[model samples]
Target: MTPPRLRPLAAALALLAAAAGVLAAPAPAAAQSAADVAVAREIFIEGSEFAKQGNWDQARERYERSLAIKRAPITLYSLGVAQQQTGLLVEALESFRAFLVEPSAPATKEYEPLARQAVQDLERRVAALEIRLSPGNVAGLAVKLDGVTVPVAALDRPRMINPGTHVVTASARGYREVRRSVSAAPGSRAILVLNLERDGVARPAAGPRAVAPRGLPAGEVAAAEPAAGNLVPIALLVGGLTTFAAGVAVGLVGVVNASDAPTRDGDAADAARAQALAGDLVAGAGLAAAGAGALVLLLGRPPESAPRAPAPRAAVSPLGLTVRF
Candidate 1:
């Protein structure tokens, strides 16, 4: 029983038979096995018969099986037609698009307009989904659209679907079944979210990760120790203070010697002049040590918080003693 809509294209059956014959010819390269081609031929014939009988489901199945054995381009169009009759608008659109994209004989080119028209019509009947999931590992969770199990790989992607009231379901081992009903509109993007919760309780959506003002990760934030300064500053201060004290004592002795020196004693006066000169040089060294110690103390500080920076690298000063981060 030929469908009323397909009767006008009865001439296409003869063309398809001719195309199948040409396809069956042995190729010099990229040829399929004789057994596979024979099987495809048998299945294709069966699909055509089923199609004529108006058993679109059986016809679609036969065409699909035939294409699986060997990609017969003719079956793509027939499959599209069968899918259209069976209310598989989305699948039909895909089939017609594939038919147009595939390289077929010039004889098949005449059907290009028909394929394009089928695609246009199906596009208006098909519904699309924009899937969403809350942040976290959703691995092993199963999803279904109207009792048909959705592939895990298809999650979180925009996909074409039949326009109808669908019961979306999500399930996992320890999670309670999450079910939501949605009325899908034709040629529109509808959001579908399957948020599975633990056992009987609902889980709240996860928020953004918290970060410390210090550049440490959440785990390391509390564990990170305060900056401990190097021993250079302490050493500088100790040496400077000791040197200054010794210089002060030496200078006092030199001052007393210089003040006590007699004008008549040339040797004593010469000795006093040497002591005063040594005292002045020692006091100058003490002043230099004190200045260096003060500089180090004043310049060195614990690093400030860098919220977004990489753990700052340690840098040694040009003097090679001070450490700056």
Candidate 2:
């Protein structure tokens, strides 16, 4: 009883001291070897020289190499800044994002502001184009932004675009090629749609007499015209007529058998079957009539002729017969 409380207090104090000691200990040295340091130094020197000379491309290369040796947030931020100066907005954004991943880096505040600005500028550049598509067709169509082919699935969302004029083209088999020119502002978005038309041999123009000289043709006129003749419609009509004739024959046989009744019980069954057959026959007859009508309509009417030039008046003869012009 005299020592239990003292033991627990002593254990707690020991644990606290160990924690303090761990916290006070110096961090382990970075694992960078001498060779790594030499490489990093060389890269830094080269990048600095490039920056001084305003050679942003070469500067970016050198800075990227230095980062490859060791992830230095400050170097990465500097590289992004150089890229931005060179109009590499997309690349700059990527670099800034990478730099921000370093939680312990002191340059996060500066990098974040610059990164946001770069993203805003990129957005503006993408917002200036207007895209329109025709025939409401969007299959197998690819869109490119600033020469980069954007995935069709990604078209619904905003994409990073570069400032300046963009050339857009749409292509698909069996459709005409469409091209458009668009301009994008810094940090803006552009919407574009492409219309596609069927590609086929141009139809020959009909003679003047074949042209319709009035308003839209009526449905009856269209149906009556022989120009609508095609194999599919003819086949459909034939099939419909055949089925209708078969149905009518079956119905007539059923009706005839039902009329010659024998016993009461059998007569009821026969009548029921006959009635069902009659219903089917009626349906088939309707179909046959429709088919016949369609076929007749298709083959019976002549195409509307174009207006013809009036004939010259003929000289009148004494015998009251008109002479030809």
Candidate 3:
């Protein structure tokens, strides 16, 4: 419906409008983080240097910092490597898996095979523990492993852990607290069951001689009271005797030196005199300590039952009533 010159002009305007729209669109995500990219690059380089020195601990720390600032696939791969070298098998496996989840790009596509291998290796080497609670529905229950609280939601699954001894503790209102020690071996799975008993329930006798049932699981071992002995008194007695013997030995040496002093002159006589004085001081201290230890040991003993003293007698005297001692 319009003239030919007008149609050409309108077409030119539409083309210009389309070009402007393209320019106004947001830039690629990579172009938007120029400052962060610079900082991340610097930190990643530092991490790489640490890795070169075989200082994986420091390398892991640096890689973590860099990854927090900017998420690059290469950084994730590096972090996984550092974590693996630091004995963090579970964490390394997770990091490697995360790296593989990122889009395959030129910077990290080469690491895909390595990451997959790491995942398989970690799966075989990681230790896991499954804790089952008897009467799991108890109210106000709390569970801890190696002093760290475990979330209730995580109780259903096997937890990955480093290979070592770990203590698991459980407590609830109106229940006796329970603690158990578990040893986790590499590439092994352990299951522990904790039984919660109500407070005021009669527990097995926990005397020093009490022993757990032989067939019971380690987690179900009965609690026993530690052995009771007067160790302090015994230790003092033994130490005192040993010290006394040493003092006697020293005193004998001093006596021999003094005996020879009468036949010596100058420095020999002075040395003998000094030795004698030192021996006397040492012997005196030893004797005092021995006496104190003996006294303590004697005092620590239970008193023997003795006949009661006769009641005081009162008798009338010539001048007044008197009492007899």
Cα lDDT computed for each candidate against the true fold? 0.69, 0.58, 0.69
What are the clashing pairs of model 1? none
**Candidate 2 TM-score over all chains jointly:** 0.42
**Model 3 CA deviation exceeding 4 Å by range:** 1-33, 199-325
lDDT by residue for model 1 over 167-264, one digit each (tens)? 77777776566778888887777987655555543344444443564666667643352223424555666787777777777777866886787773
Residue-level error in angstroms, candidate 3, position 28: 6.3
Task: Name the better of 1 and 3 by TM-score.
Answer: 1
> How does model 3 fare in lDDT?
0.69
* TM-score ranking from best candidate downward: 1, 3, 2
Cα lDDT tens digits for candidate 3, 78-131: 788788888888788889899899887654454577678778888888899999
Give candidate 3's root-mean-square deviation (CA, Å): 28.7
**Judged by TM-score relative to the true structure, which candidate is superior, 1 or 2?**
1
For candidate 1, the per-residue lDDT at 266 reads 75
Deviation from truth (RMSD, Å), model 2: 28.1
What's the C-alpha lDDT at position 84 in model 3? 82
